[model samples]
Target: MARIQTMRVDRMLSSMGYGSRSEVTRMGKAGIITLDAAEIADAARRIAVTPDLPARMKIDGEALDPLTGVVILLNKPLGMTCSHKDSGVLIYTVLPDRWRRRTPVIATVGRLDKQTSGLILLTDDGDLLHRIISPRSRVRKTYRATLARPLAGNETELFASGELMLDGDAKPLAPAELSVVSETEAIISVTEGRYHQVRRMFAAAGNHVTELHRERLGGLSIPDGMASGQWALLEADNIASIFHMDPAKQT
Candidate 1:
């Protein structure tokens, strides 16, 4: 038979942000932790940490939060900072408070500025987070901008030229796509995640962006009926779609 995987019950709970080692021991003594319907009175005891651990364990009459990798898609709201330690209301506050206490910590895959609102991914999986944010991924991020002025007509060519340079940047941006929805609104898609790139691009074109909202990232788009600050805890398979570009989203 293959070797069995296991971990200290207290360590699992504490790492998941349930509590500290001593606190877990107290929880065990209080009959608050259980495995497979049996009371786990010794938090120090090692238990099998399997794919089914979440279903097998209960804490305070609730199933354990997904232990290993947790991913969530949030419709980031305006005026909210993504940093965990940022003062006042933060994007982290919209998620479970216990999530912030997790060992590896849940962090945004890439930042969206405080004034910008749109699709943002947060995950506890370090590798997955890095993969998404890496420039080599070439994942397309689409932003719909409301402009203060009407179309200049040449913006489409300028962005698609693949030679547009933002101030202070040493390299030209990769080819980007621009779609005009109307005289004062346009959608721009880019593979780069440069700082304030979309707004800067508009400024370079001599237009002011009155509002900016990300519509999609790769294949992930904010689902209908989801309000600002709303989020969906994603399944394992759903994570793959983050790397798959949807051709239909180009429209």
Candidate 2:
């Protein structure tokens, strides 16, 4: 029931990080915001700051918080949708209940096409999410891709020299590393995460990717024994390593 006085409900909820201003306003006007037994009819209702405002606040009978954040990782499995719809199975539905109850809301840092499977970070910390995902940060991610062709001498050098195209786009990507793991499999590392980047990059090189699995992010990797569809709480040290900083220095 946390509450803050404001001229508009959208403004208040947006400031609290629930979502964009327009989204909150739409919810408010739809009779989603309520107090006691009465629906909050106006999107611009003035009120005093009170914890009770958000306390037990339910949209479609689901409690929500306007000012909290969450950070967690999910080993996304293929064939599952990443959306919030209830029809098809989603990544969040597979998470243990204990990890689902966090303040504000957490969204996948980036995206993995429904066919792709691997470590996906979900967080509500906007700054941290942006820092780790932004191309400007040069955060590298490694992937093991099963391809249709074997990469040899010149192929690896070409990949590392940024000499590949992305579909119709003429711009070459930043330098990436490619190591042939098998006749039809390779490990690739790239810092620029364009849409369908890995799959398209391989396709551009006269190969097709049959499967793409992310193994590392920001120089940190998932530990052994962490099964697919399982998640674990990240430690403070884990966050520090992404920046190459010791936790002690951060404090």
Candidate 3:
């Protein structure tokens, strides 16, 4: 004999955020839930549950479902916020409408200020996001900064020794690689992520950063061909390389 299964429908709906348990119970009592036009007798009745997309449970004709998750990298353009809320102008607005409709929700793993432009990772993969972002994971991020004034004095040594102070904070920043590629341009690499770190470091060094662009994260370098405001899907090898393991070394 097949084993009988049972659960309160309202409880399941509540768990999924369809409504509060009390509210769902009221909806059922008010003759809202129906399959093929027959009203469900009890909100507590056992019912089979199945996953469906593009279809959802209805409450007085209002449909609802949990957002599905996805991972994406956006070459975030200037003047867009990473947040999901309708923040006037946002990065998601630039994406094709179909991508915006995906479930789970995609978020920019690390953020770039509205005026600071470059590659930004957006994803719903919790484990992968953690691996790429955890401070203990020691993932390195590289940025190309253009300064309003050329760097001079003890800036190079200060950056090399990681002795630059970022203001009221008593402790110094982690060791970082700072090198000048030109008189007015330089590259800064650091593992510790702090609020406005690159710009602040340059400011601390007595050189004001005029423009900031992130060029690399972990082992993945920004593709030379990709331009601002455009994005590409990362391949498996790209994801694997972020952990410092050579993708080619794997069998």
Candidate 4:
């Protein structure tokens, strides 16, 4: 069985964006919050936030489900900026108003440039985001890139050897995998997320990236049926897959 995780009432409520810690404390004192049908006056009281526990919690007559953290996978479309501030079309605008208003603020795990498109993960769980994007985790990100010129000889070996250097970098990138799909298009997989890494890597190899589309991240692939600008909730199993582990076996 999965172990139960606990958090203080005020911290949980505030993290979910209900209000500030002091405000939640005040609400608790006013008898607006309850745990398992019993009135809870102490904001610091710890309660289970795990699925393994049966904890019925409510605030002001509304039920709360703390165990199920929000995670979403988006089929990001081109011409959208992955930002809250509008430089071009804001990617967050594509999501429903409720998701945007979520407490703790659901954020994109990693950014895709304005012209890039494909799978993007958004989540309210900070730990999951860090695990997926951290270089130390070595999570694989796969991209299908269209090049301005045909891939030249020895480039694939160079990429696989992790010896290609970008401008202003003293060291070569970690080893990557490359496969040719056509003369001008190929699939590339890397474990790092440097700025314009794909484009710069190609440029350093004497080629230029004309178009780039991310196809996969970690063990999650963009669903073929998902249309551009669409999104779907990532269930617990999907979350587990991000770490390349089985949900039942996850600690």
For model 3 the TM-score comes to 0.68
lDDT by residue for model 2 (29-134), tens: 7887776656776766765545455564565455545334446777778876666664667777775443344334566778777888887887768888888888
lDDT of 4 by residue, 212-239 (tens): 9998887788877999999888878777
User: By descending lDDT, how would the candidates be arranged?
Assistant: 1, 4, 3, 2
TM-score (C-alpha) between model 1 and the true structure: 0.95
Across 47-154, the per-residue lDDT of candidate 1 in tens digits comes to: 888888899889999998887788999999999898978786789999777878898888998999998999999998999999998999998899999999998999
Top TM-score hit:
1
How displaced is residue 140 in candidate 4, in Å?
A: 0.3
Whole-model lDDT values for every prediction = 0.90, 0.71, 0.72, 0.83
Error of 3 at 238 (Å): 1.0
| Candidate 4 residue spans exceeding 4 A from truth | 1-68, 245-251
**How well does candidate 2 match the true structure, expressed as C-alpha RMSD?**
8.0
Ranking 1 against 4 by TM-score, winner: 1
Q: On TM-score, who's better, 2 or 4?
A: 4
Query: Candidate 2 — worst ten consecutive residues by lDDT sum?
Result: 242-251
Cα lDDT, model 4, residue 117: 94
